[model samples]
Target: MSNISKKNKGYFSEEIVKNYYINNGFKFIEQNFTVKGGELDLIFSKVGSLKFIEVKNIDGINDLFDYITKKKLNFLIKTINIYLYKFDITNIDYSLDVVFVKKNEIYEIYDNIGI
Candidate 1:
């Protein structure tokens, strides 16, 4: 696929994930949050807990677990730390979550693959 097509697919997947979270009662804080180190796909809050979510849209080529590499997780952690420090957020519960999108199916794994 071309770069444009890949970008569009990413945006579409993000939109779907955003809507799914909203429908499930999570309040949206930001999307496509970028820092100097890395980018976070979505940020949301629910019941006083903040969630830094990474949305992965799988095209059946690789397993979901394969996407959460050590380097990627480290980058994500750094990004989240930057976000928190930038916003002066302290003492609030937070977690890093991964949302896997497979067509119409969605699954979320929270605070497991990422710290």
Candidate 2:
């Protein structure tokens, strides 16, 4: 796909993921959070824990292995930290998660992969 097509697809996938999360009882915090060269697709709270969610429009977990680069993970981690600091949010557990959407199905991985 072209760059523009890919970006629009990505944004649409994120919106789908966000809605799925919300329907499943997650509190939506923000979407398309950007800071400098870093960005996080979704930030949410669930069962007293804060979730930094990365949505991937992939078939499965294995498909994510090649997609989440180390550099991108570093950027995401730094951005989440900055967001926490900027908002003065503390005293709650946090985790990195991925919501993989394929067709009409949704699969979630909670702190399963390091990135």
Candidate 3:
């Protein structure tokens, strides 16, 4: 596939994951949140917990560790902190999550990621 096509596919995959989260009872708070060199794909709330989500269209999430390097993690952490500080949100527990979209299946990993 061409680069443009792949980019489009990735965007569609993220949209699908966003809808899935919404359908599954997560309140959509934000998307494609960026500050400086960092980007968090989605921010949401579920069961009273704040979620900082990263959406990926890859086949496996185990490889995510390789892709989201330390520098990127630092950036994302800084961004999330800035967001919380800017919004004065200190009551909710927050976690980093990953939504993986495959061909016909979606997988979610939560709370353990440092990103």
Candidate 4:
């Protein structure tokens, strides 16, 4: 991972997160969904609840939460709204989450992390 490119490191990190969620019974929905102003790293659905995940490859970061800045959360909110409108998702449970990965390990997960 140390030698891998930044882009590949992100993809690798997402795969780890994806498998973890799938193993936990969440169906994989989408990844790297991008719009003009934002991007969603991963999406999942479980029992009518839509889960939006923001993944950060914190290879050398000290604090996991620091990666999720206010600006980033705003972008995520805007992107999720667009996603719901685009897919016509209504009357469903949804939440935002963040997953931090470091050295091929899942460091921490923050759920319902809305501002």
Candidate 5:
């Protein structure tokens, strides 16, 4: 796929995940949140806890954990730190989450492998 097509697919997938979260009672904070060296696909909150979510759209991929690299995990951590620092948020509970999308099916893995 071309770069543009890939981007469009990613955007659509993110939107799908975002809507799913919203429907499930998570309030959306941001989408495509970017910092200096990394980007977070979605940020949401439920109750008083914050969630930094990374979304992946795949076709026929069985191993979802394979998509998250160490480098990507580090980048996400740094990005979340920056977001908290920039917003001066402290003492708030937070966790990293992953959302996997395959066609109309959506699955969420919460605080599983990476933090």
Candidate 6:
């Protein structure tokens, strides 16, 4: 698919995952939080724990790792830092999580896939 088509699919998947989290009692904080080099697909909070989520629309399990590369992880960390500083969030406890969506269903939810 083209970039636009792929992006639209990604957005749709993000929405699906957003609702999935909300249904599970997580409060939505933000979506599509973007900086120069990367974007946070979703931000959520529950019981004082904050989560920075990356959403992927995948066709197979292997496709999920394609999104988790060294460069991408570094960029994601930098983006999270920028988000925390810009929003003045300090020492609040956070994690980097990934949610994989296939079509309209959630394929898998992985928490704290850190490098």
**Winning model by TM-score:** 4
Which lDDT tens digits does candidate 6 get at residues 18-95? 998899999999999998999999999988778899987877666567768888889989999999899898878889
lDDT of 5 by residue, 1-115 (tens): 4445768888988888889889989999998889789999999999898999898887777677779888889999999999999999999989998888877468655463466
Residue-level lDDT of model 1, residues 61-111, one tens digit each, is 456678888899999999999999999999888888888876646754445
User: In model 5, what are the clashing residue pairs, if there are any?
Assistant: none
Q: Write the per-residue lDDT of candidate 4 for residues 1-115, one digit (tens) a residue.
A: 2678999999999999999999999999999999999999999999989999998888587767678888989999999999999999999999998998888999889988983
Residue 86 miss distance in model 5 (angstroms)? 0.4
Comparing 3 and 6 by TM-score, which wins? 6
Please give each candidate's TM-score.
0.87, 0.80, 0.79, 0.94, 0.89, 0.89
What's the true lDDT of residue 91 in model 6?
Answer: 70
Cα lDDT tens digits, model 2, 1-115, are 3444667777878888888779989999999889998888999998888889888776445755576788878888898898899999898788887667665357655463453
RMSD of 2: 3.0
- Evaluate residue 90 in candidate 3 and report its C-alpha lDDT on the 0 to 100 scale: 87
Clashes of each: 0, 0, 0, 0, 0, 0
Query: Model 6: how far is 76 from its true place, Å?
Result: 0.8
**Cα shift from native, residue 13, model 5 (Å):** 0.5
Quick one: ranking by lDDT, best first? 4, 6, 5, 1, 2, 3
Clashing pairs in 3: none
RMSD, candidate 1, Å: 2.3
lDDT of each: 0.83, 0.78, 0.77, 0.92, 0.85, 0.87
Candidate 1 yields a Cα-based lDDT of: 0.83
Query: Candidate 5, residue 20: CA error in Å?
Result: 0.9
- Quote the positional error of residue 26 for candidate 5 in Å: 0.9
Q: In model 6, where is the ten-residue run with the lowest total lDDT?
A: 58-67
